[model samples]
Target: MMFEENPPSSYLTRAAHSEDSQETITAISHVLRDQEDTQLVPADDSESFAAPGDLPANPTSPQQRLAKLKLLMTQQKAEYESKIARLEQRNRELQWEIRDTQWQLGQQRQRHRLAEMKIRNAERAKEDAERRNEMLQKEMEEFFETFGEINGWK
Candidate 1:
């Protein structure tokens, strides 16, 4: 007997005896009847279903597309975070450099002020030494004149 498109005669006869063949035939008939009674209902026209061609044409299902987009976003976010971290590190280095530069400038200015003070002090000392030398020269010249006058009287 035929069950759906398959003939049960071949499977039933393959068994050892007539009783076994009858039992096999009965089981196959029951399965076929159950399948026929519980037929799968088709989807409505408004409802969308994934066709076999759809996945190959689109290259991604809706869930897979969302996951891919999320992955790309996460990668971009990580890159941006790394860039920001690098920039922050560079900014800190620049701040340190600026502080060092300012310290150098202050030290140079201090040295310049000290040099100017030393120059002013040297100028004052030179002026005082010149005044003392002029006074000593005048005193020596007067003593020589008095001594010459005294010697002439002899």
Candidate 2:
């Protein structure tokens, strides 16, 4: 389901401020740090190197710094792409779970309907048996009375 169609406000707020989101941000920062540390930049290429806590004052060579920026952007792009892929896979899993729950609900409803039908049938059978028993009891009483009358015992 698309979240934008009928998104819950609480869900959006929770997602934005979630621990997982914060961890992902922290991980991306670490990745950027690691990449920067691993790259070997020559000391003579001072145009691309920015001093710690100091902004690059030289605007003479923009191309070198532009190349470094492009590289960093590419790495971050890859990290974000992988994260998106994982989130998509999780979405699919959740959809399947919802479908399974719905199927179980349908099956339970069918069983409940069947149970109700059986109960009604049982009630009808009980009523029929009680009626027959009353008819048989009346006939027995009449037979005993007739026999008693013919034998002159009454």
Candidate 3:
């Protein structure tokens, strides 16, 4: 039956000559043209759109071929999106790891500085103690010398 002869009660009709119908038909034609223009070409035997000689001998109708191309395109898109997401997630993790490493390095450097300061302080303390010990030794020697001279004169 002609599409208009048994027009489904639910179908809405507009004058064919109306501007709206013309616009609608134009839009539909554009879509169809786009679909036709984007015909897939197979590059290798593994591709879904490969010709029969380039692919397995399994028979496939034109409808099946189109369906296969569409499915392949969808699968490729999903795979690409998934890979991008994973890479982004990995980048975030690496960035966090780098920040943590930098923080630890800073802490280690501070500890090293504190250790160096302690060593310097210890060296100074040792030098002061040595000087005091030498002074005490010289005073003791002078005292003994004086005592010996007095005894000898007596």
Candidate 4:
């Protein structure tokens, strides 16, 4: 944190600053990096990072490592944020779909109820028509019998 507040000028750039001042900045930043790592890796276990060929023999500056770590953390954060956004979008879409389905289901139930009511009404009409037809048939039979007796026919 202190290093960021007063970052050490690069070795290539010098403006009225003594060599001792540059060395002091480098040492302070390095100490800060070590302290930050102490919470994770042991202080004596620097070799656990990488192979000798891959790792620098001596890290004169801590800026490179800090920058790399920052970049990695930034990428991981972006990935998580993107994933969360997609999940939220999907959830909203699913909610809308569920609502639409429920509305359709309600409509279907209403239609079914209306159809059943119509069927019941048609059944009642059919029964009434059948009763009328039976009455007309009985009246016709009695009329024929009376006519036959009046005409002296069987």
Candidate 5:
């Protein structure tokens, strides 16, 4: 009957100052006050929370409200822990991928070095063959001139 006569704001004001009024208020109000004191309010809602001493829309008893809050806290904790685990697993996978990429790059560098060495060796072999051919041609020309002079075939 007193609650019906007095407004919710007046009850909040009385509860703020009086210990007797705090007992009359719901436990949820006390919990909210405790959270505010410790700066640990749940971050589920972006909008402003209901003011302290505000009644639930359905008017549940203090015990029921407290139990509901406990259950909600448990669920949120589990969800956050699961998210952290998934993120850790993804981080490990990324590290493995980086290692594999580095290994492939090393292999490519070794192959490139071997290919350059082969090209240089082939170029050197070609030069040696050309020099040998030139020497043989000179020898054949000298033999022909000597034979022509001895046979009197100016």
Candidate 6:
């Protein structure tokens, strides 16, 4: 038998006889009788009507079984192919994400290196400014010593 996602509507279990109202049954029967191809099989009459020898031979002979099996295999193959396609798409998405993450990480590393260089340059400039200030202070002191006597109490 072929695998099915859902039972056919006709094969589904109906409400119990106690749950079915007479009006519902009458309405259903009327609708069914109106249909040209609808045959409401009597629940117990068919067994009594046909003798053992009168019944048809096994409908699912080897050839029919083989055909059904082939159909089932085809359906299974289609389902597998669909699943594989979806999984392949997912894998491609994951690979893209990985590459994006790597690119972002590389950008961050570049930014970090640039920041460190900026910090080093600023520190070197600060040290140079400090040395210039010290030299200027010594010059000012020497000028004061040499010119204080000329300008005032010599």
Using Cα atoms with residue i matched to residue i, what is each candidate's TM-score against the true structure? Answer: 0.60, 0.57, 0.55, 0.58, 0.52, 0.53
Q: Which is the leading candidate under TM-score?
A: 1
lDDT values of the candidates?
0.57, 0.56, 0.56, 0.57, 0.56, 0.53
Better-scoring candidate (TM-score), 2 or 3: 2
Better of 2 and 4 by TM-score: 4
Model 3, 56-79: lDDT tens digits are: 444543443544454455456556
Global CA lDDT of candidate 3, please? 0.56
- How far residue 51's Cα lies from its native spot in candidate 4, in Å, is 20
| Cα distance off (Å), candidate 4, residue 45 | 18
lDDT of 2 by residue, 54-115 (tens): 43445322433444454455557667878999999999999999999999999999999999
Q: Which is better, 2 or 5, measured by TM-score? A: 2
Where does candidate 4 stray beyond 4 Å?
1-66
RMSD of 4: 12.7
RMSD over all Cα atoms, model 6 = 13.6
lDDT of 4 at 153: 57
* Alpha-carbon runs more than 4 Å astray in model 5: 1-58, 61-70
Where does the lowest 10-residue lDDT sum fall in candidate 3?
1-10
Error of 6 at 91 (Å): 1.5
Q: Measured by TM-score, how close is model 4 to the native structure?
A: 0.58
lDDT of 4 by residue, 1-154 (tens): 1123233223213332333443444554564565346322212323233323343455422544544444445456656777999999999999999999999999999999999999999999999999999999999999988888888953
Q: What are the per-residue Cα lDDT tens digits for candidate 1 across 1-154? A: 1123432223323433434534554554554443335331112222233344333444434433333344445456656777999999999999999999999999999999999999999999999999999998898889899999999999
Q: Which candidate do you rate higher for TM-score, 1 or 5?
A: 1
Residue 17 of candidate 1: its Cα lDDT? Answer: 40
Q: Which window of ten consecutive residues has the lowest lDDT sum in model 2?
A: 1-10
Candidate 5, residue 65: CA error in Å? 4.7
